[model samples]
Target: MSEHQRAMLNHIREVNQHIENLVTDYWKAYSGIDTWQFWLNAVLLIIPLVFLLIYIDRRRVFQILFFGYTIHVLMNYLDITAVLKGLMYHPYSLLPMPQSHLTLDASLIPVAFMLTYQLGYNRRINQYLLAVVIGAVMSFIFGPIVHAIGFLKMYHWMSYWVLFIGDIIEYIIAYWLTSFFFHFYRNDEPTS
Candidate 1:
């Protein structure tokens, strides 16, 4: 690599290391087990998973799990992008990963979407409508509540409406992908 390129790479690495260190410090000071924020984050991460384990449809376990996994992946990507762009951030979290608030990105939101998808599948309800409703609840209600308690903070024109729209879009994408894959899977099954 050229000298300038190497210098830029070094600077980026330094910044990344600094960010990791800051995240660890913040977690230790405010997000550890002694704080209520930590407990809340822990609960947010655990309860939804428990519900999913207990209530997930056994007949369609793989399909439901795949759908939820898609949601988790999409949200993690969005979370990293938003944090990197300074659009939003989690001040406290169960994990020291600077790009995501693990409770919401990996647990609560994905599990919520999974259960919602399961409900729609079982009832043959409209998923688009479910997406919108769930999006609103997560973006407006849960987001604000988390913000109010200092877990999340929005910045740089990132409003609740923006989050609402993003949530709906991601949900639609995940739903479409999951349905498309399972449709083909069903079609390819051997006839009795």
Candidate 2:
């Protein structure tokens, strides 16, 4: 092989070795099953899921499930992006993924929004208002608790307000997308 090719290969190998070391250090520090944080994250991921299974409205099961799924997908996407961009980090994680706080992004946040959507949809209350309230609780209350407990770390210019706004926007996008689909299926024409 050419000398330039050999140099490039050496660089790639060094980078991979560094990544491997990081993974090893991460597992040693955070992945222990005996740790309280791990157990807490595990419960956070599982309890809401069990509750959703037991209490989800059967009458509008499809709509609620789809909406929650959309929220979960977008939340994970945005979370991974934020982590990659160095906006925040989760010190403890239940899974070994690039994005930490899997429980919150994958389950709790989505389930909370799902229940709020159901409440609004069934009771004829304004979903947007309910979402804003949820966002406030998540931002002003839950976020601080999580940070204080050492589960989350915010860096750079990121703060609870960013989470607050992002949570609201995520809910709105998921609600609109799910509603659009419901309308399309029922009326065969898209609604505004």
Regions more than 4 Å wrong, model 1: none
Q: What would the per-residue lDDT of candidate 1 be over residues 40-136, giving only the tens digit for each residue?
A: 8888999999989999999999999999999999988988899889999889888776765889988899998999899999999999999998999
Compared with the true structure, the alpha-carbon lDDT of candidate 1 equals 0.90
Q: What TM-score against the true fold does each predicted structure earn?
A: 0.96, 0.87
Best by lDDT: 1
| Candidate 2 to native Cα RMSD, angstroms | 3.9
Clash pairs for candidate 1 = none
Clashes of 2: 0
The true-versus-predicted C-alpha distance at residue 124 of model 1, in Å, is 1.0
Mind giving the per-residue lDDT tens digits that candidate 2 earns over 1-192?
999999999999998688657755785687657678888999999999998888889999999999999998988888878888999988788875546568898888888889989999999999899879999999999999999999889999999999999999999999999999998778975679
Residue 4's lDDT within candidate 2 is 100
